[model samples]
Target: MHKKAIYIMMLVAVLLASCSSPGRKALELSDNMLKTAPERALAILDSIENAGGLNREEQLHLVWNRAMAHQIMGMSLAEDEQLPEAIIHYREEADKQTDSYLLEASYLNWKGKRADAINVLNKGIGKIKDSTKRVKLMAEQARLLELQREYSKAAEVMERALELNPTKRDKAILNYKIGLNLSLAGDPRSEQFYSQSVRMATENGDTAMACEFLRNYADYLANNGKYRQSNNVYREISRMMPQMAGLSAIQMAMAGNYINLHMPDSARICNEKAIESEARLEAKGFDDISRRMVIELERCLLDYGDGKPVSYVGLSRYCDSITADMHAKESTLARRQEAKERLQWANHELRLDRQRMGWMLAAAVLLLLLGVAGGWIYYRNRLSRLAEAENSIDTLKRMLKETQTPAEETPEEKQQKSEDDAFFKKILLQQLGIIRMVASTPTNHNQALLKRIAGISEGKIQTDSLLVWPDLYLVIDRLYDNFHNRLTERYGNVLTEKEIQIACLLCAGFSTKEIGVVTQQSDATIYVRKTSIRKKTGAAEGQDIVSYINGIKAD
Candidate 1:
């Protein structure tokens, strides 16, 4: 009887293995097309008659490909009904591979369906049994919450992930993520997690990751106004990665820390080293011209700090050039991203044509012709816009060069320029305060404050009866050769009234603190408003907002 039972079990095992082979092969074929031709990949996945024959891992792979296909095709999760089959398979093995759910949720979040993404992950977390898998889902959930700016809730989710006792590497990464969210949430306990992450990563022999964690720790310290400690961390990183490619970044950060610490000599030395390293990197084909401009600006700051003569026009040119480079890079990046999306959609349509060629040949031909026409029109419009932008940039650059230190200026011109420079300096100082505010606290209060600032800037709310926005506008127009009217005419539609107000403030010599006091709000509120202004203006990171605003030439 025992011999007969063994024979029967062996025969059943052979049958199960044979049945799974076709499903595995189908999965492999679909996987290859997931990236470039995901619509076809989905069709192949749909053709699989029995996913039940595949194991948990294979089932998860199928679902992952399916989810990715739906994402690439810009289809909602609800459109792909097969995505949930993997979750329904083998309830006992549910914890084995849950990454599909995470990927699906990520796609949903990217589509601005953040609430749906959270719900999907919550469902997965409830279904998952094992600690490791559950933590993976929870970690992703925490990440999504972070994007929603619910930093406190993100920290809580991360804490729950930690309670599950993840693997060593996972624990290290989780600790860093938790610290990041906690820090963003303005919780002091973030320091503990940051330290723990560094220690854990170092002990795990992941020195690179440890250094990365240490960098974040240093940034957090610097952000919280602990310059000395932040520099210490930077020094430690310097020791760890002495010959690293990113040495210039570390040195530049150290220079800023030293400046904050009121040590100009040390700051200058660090700045010089940063410039040297940057030059070396540039020689090695690093195309980040903006960083070099930033270093030059820092040098100007150092010179000014030492009571040396600093050419204001030269500084203005540098600011304008940096802002231009930033705008170009941003435009290129945006176009490239859109191009990729269009390519994916094109591939999706091609696959649909092939599948329906026999029945809808005439319709497919008509749609193809329309698509080509539309694409051509879009391409032409894009080129025209790009040409116009380039022309505008060229005109601005020519204006700056032409305006540079004319040989003989009238007394009125010199006084006006000097006043402009002074106002620019005031705006620069105010912007520094605004940047600091952005770094410190990013909360709901800041959001409300942004709206309030916008209201005041747009003239919806009057802070000063004597100098309402329109009155201030006229003052700016009279002072700067109708700069207010010209700026409005040029960027009136692109910039909100609030942004126009801030720009006027930049030109009018209003300090950030003065704005804050007048608005009856904190500097943090103004920071949020200033950040929005920067985005709308497309100003480069670390570039002078005042310079960018004032450098605009009416077309």
Candidate 2:
């Protein structure tokens, strides 16, 4: 009875192996097309099509594989600039005996039948039960709409694609496409869409896409007369992709736009930056684009600043020609056709080889299953070993953690940290008070207060020793002198130097503790001086001490 059961099991396994379809073989052929080995791919696909005793599933797979081979060949021809010939092969594959709506849609889309492309995609979406495949079809349709310049419709379709479950990469692309459509539509809400795309790209860690978003945002800002903001955005672009050759040209263009907005200083700064970048590129022998950009920028600067108009006849013409030549040599499809064909052919051969090997893999898998069945008792032994290893790891980890010691903080260390924190807090409060005081005063008072604040913030202050109080006193005296000079310039004959110092202390809006820390004076003395200064400055009712000081301005 045991022998009979073994024989029956072996027979069932053999029958199942025989029933396996040629799908993997077809996939291998399809992969060859990607490697530009179209002839080899076609040969493998033809062998599959001619293989005898194939069931319906195997026949369908073979047809699909053959279609892929043709599609790859068409791509190769397109790369060779034989567009019409490529289209012919693409059409042939589209009409092949296959149920792959994706392949059909792709071919139709490339053939410029936009409506037919969308129709084929819709059919695929309806017929495909897999959520992943359905979303892919929707994305393709949305891309087609975008290419047709139907931006609103494209955005709506992309929204639907986003509704479907997508990988992070797909979501990023979807957001970018939506932003692009919104921008093309010229809607004010495009900024929000672009921002969303930027966030998505940043999350995905796609530096190139992030740079592109920054460039577009900068252009938008410049067009809207936000020159300073646009310059900031361009700076971000330069920081992100310093080696990008086009940035020099972009910076120069932005500088010219700044000049148009009457920001000559900013324009000069941008122009200088572009010239520096171009010089660096020239030094590295990557100066083709950079050199041209420098010339154009120099011309623009002269035109805007020195009354010399830019001439586009000689240098511009040459620059455009060079750009065209470089583009043709790079990622252009026409230059890569031969490689594409070879890849297709290799993929097709690999498919047939895999199909033959599939039976061997099945036999190995069956042997593995038998080993697993016989080793059930040994499985427990393996688990015991794993458990022992894990326990050992846990013991080592605990020991490591216990052996580690955190450094102890000294008294001076703790005190320094506290002082640093307090210093930053004081700075923050002082800044807020200055802004509020300046905003609340009259125009003349506002100018005087701004000048005083600028003086205080201009240079670094030295605080070397807490024991040497004279250094601290010197810093305070210097700050007071600056305040007095600015205040005297704006408000003449209103307050004496002593009163000005007292008024400045009041206008700072400091608490008693802060005032003592800043001025090296007692809180009671500060209060007494403030009262005396207020009386001397003005005797009006309902006037705050800070307001009274700001109220003194020369006509």
Candidate 3:
């Protein structure tokens, strides 16, 4: 028996030593990798991989680390514009392991053969059973689909990914991707989907994703004439991604929506940002679509700044200059000319009125008399309605105040209430016993117990003032009874209510003032109560209140 026990102890020690060995090595490697040369890190990983007699887990870890190093190397090459070399390294890393198919897909996609990359991913998805891995692959596939302008298909892929992994982290990314696809699709139903995605992303703690979704959602809402919601979403996006290029231009486009919603000040701010973002985009050599968007945003800013309704002629000129679509630009210009001609014809008709002075003078005198009579009658009716409403509101207010007051109870009634309270306390204790039997387990029912106690206490005390007393012994008794019973059931013995309260107060590491606020007692009184409770409970010296509470169980 002694030899067997010694062998077991030795085995346990060996296992613990082995566990400690890898953790320290991993930490050391991680710390060195942060400051060490990349080539050196790669060499170390390569040595580990080639080291004979290593276990399968160790070999896999080495392979994973080397792959990460290669990926970082490829990214640096790409950033330096060495695409061919970057592609070679990325492809080599991807080809090293069958488990890392997503990396391979990314490499192929970036190499400009998107279809081939997606097919590779499809094969891997069929083989992988892990839902998390599958979800990640699907999201990557959706991103590729978005780049290809297959918006509907991309949305479908994102939805499938979300269905596979309903965790908040996954949901946030999925919703943002879906919103992006819908925004590109330009369908009215896209607005609804984008809004839902923005809300989900925000709830899931993905602020960056939420910001991206809100930006797209705002654009969709503005286009659909939901200006108020669109403007609000734009403001949120601006606040989140203040440094994002083209943000000001996007906000400028949204300014028109804000103005239409009767928010000129907000519109002006949006317009200013739009102009600034556009200037930044120009400096950065933005694409033709982005340039055209900036020009339109600038026109909008100018129109709003000048306090004029955006003129069709000015809009047409602006659109013609920047729009890439020849046919659309021509059509807009033609419409503007037609509108201008119509306005001139109306103005010309008004000019003819200058020759007919005698008839115009008589008509103006009669119109003035009619206006004066109508204004007087309208003002009198409005005043009468206002007076009636005021009187009705005053009567309702008085009735409400009367209903809020409590009825006064006599001395005999007070004595009867006192007798009733004692009877209810007995009934409450019996009910508590019933609850304990029903619960039959340690559970988080403290709030439920409090509710039951409050009901019982209310039955005893008829007056609100009595019920809300600072030193309500009945409430404390009920609270203690519930906690003590649960603790006893769990542990066979536990601290009394006063002891638990005192220990919790002390253990909470709170000041006397804080304890007073929590317990609704004065600081001096709380200190006194804590002292008495601690002495009765016999808590160990220097033990924390939280630790003591944690130890107790109502078994």
Candidate 4:
């Protein structure tokens, strides 16, 4: 048992030793330093002599660090373009995509193909799912945009990068860079960003960085005619002056602000302090001619502000020349930016046109499908109606053959028969027209006409008694050779008026459901009425009601 316990202890120690191995420690260190000091990271990564003992993850990590370090340092993995081969060696998809995009973009940028580099980064930003990798790519893109003098676009991209959840230090740095870009773009919002950056740096315990940020913010205020606010920021920087550099420059800027505020005495005091600081710097053998020139210019400004009468043509000419040079540079930058904006707008418009064409094509295809479906339905309905018409014609022929004979008739009877046939045909054609109109249009007028026809057939329109079915019974009697008259005469005592109407509709070749619609009754009621009629008329079971009515000639 003691030997077993000792073996367990040894195993535990071996695991701990492997977990904190020297190569793994160096990998972590190099990765941390990749953004801050790429050259140092590359040297540390190169010092790894033996990677054979490392695990697979450690090995992949080693390769990734080397590739990234070289890219950051603006060098290639191989002098002859073997960098892409190294990039694809990563197996994990997110890491592989990140390295491939960032490495390629960096390579292109180094080769003086900044536009292609931006395109590659944009593609990667769209395709990469990892937020960290997207942030890295955006940072590179922002760098390229800055190089192209597109300060507004650069600031916009940096704002997007901050939303990707970078580290606190990175967020502070991003705010500072965004402020710098906005200041270059001549946007007033840069003051807000600068203030935010200073606040964040102070909270992060970066005093030197905070003071540096305050210096720039003060300069921006002074340039924009906010001399009082600029003086306040300068005082804030003076609180941290021991940790800051360029005291002489700060004093000169304060003197300019005082001079702008028309406080000549305060301006003279600041100028004297600046001269003293400059002398001290010169004593340290770190002096420049520009510092003396700037100090003399401040003295001249103080003399002019004090209303000293002096010849000032040389100073005016020198100031004009400097202002003209600044304006020329600004105008050139504006034209270049305008051209770039036009190109970007053209590309955006082309993409929008492609999307619009796709939507139009989809809409056209959908319309065509609907049209085909509607045409098919219409054709089927027309064929059904034609078949119904042919069956109706056959029924008329069969009735004529069953009822007509070859015997001669008197002229009076023949004329009466011909008039009844013409009148009945006219009524039938009017009924068919009303039904067809209702089927096609279903307007209120057409529906009213259909109901009026139904009322006429049911003998319900009392105001026009001659139009009722019973009043027209003479014409129907002659048309059917008095067969319908005899059937009603025999069964009229037992049948209701509703039942008689249903019987008339049935003999006219209307189905039970159609009869119900004409009479405004349910189909079940129509079926019950038909059964009652069959019983009362003594018709045999399994015989059709219409055929039974036709067979009845006399009681």
Measure candidate 1: CA RMSD: 46.6
Error of 4 at 355 (Å): 63
Winner on lDDT between 2 and 3 is 2
lDDT of each: 0.72, 0.59, 0.56, 0.72
Measured against the true structure, the TM-scores of the candidates, in listed sequence, are 0.47, 0.41, 0.37, 0.41
441-512 in candidate 3: lDDT tens per residue? 344755554443333322332223222322334443353334333333443344455445444334323445
Stretches of candidate 2 above 4 Å error?
Answer: 1-99, 223-225, 239-246, 249-253, 268-298, 301-304, 309-555
Please report the candidate that would top TM-score against the real structure. 1
lDDT of 2 by residue, 208-236 (tens): 88878877877776766677787777777
How many clashes would you count in candidate 2?
21
Query: Relative to the unseen true structure, what is the Cα RMSD of model 2?
Result: 44.9
After superposition on all C-alphas, the RMSD of every candidate to the true structure, in Å, is: 46.6, 44.9, 38.3, 26.8
Cα lDDT of model 3 overall? 0.56
**lDDT (0-100) at residue 208 of candidate 4?**
84
As a TM-score, model 2 comes out at 0.41
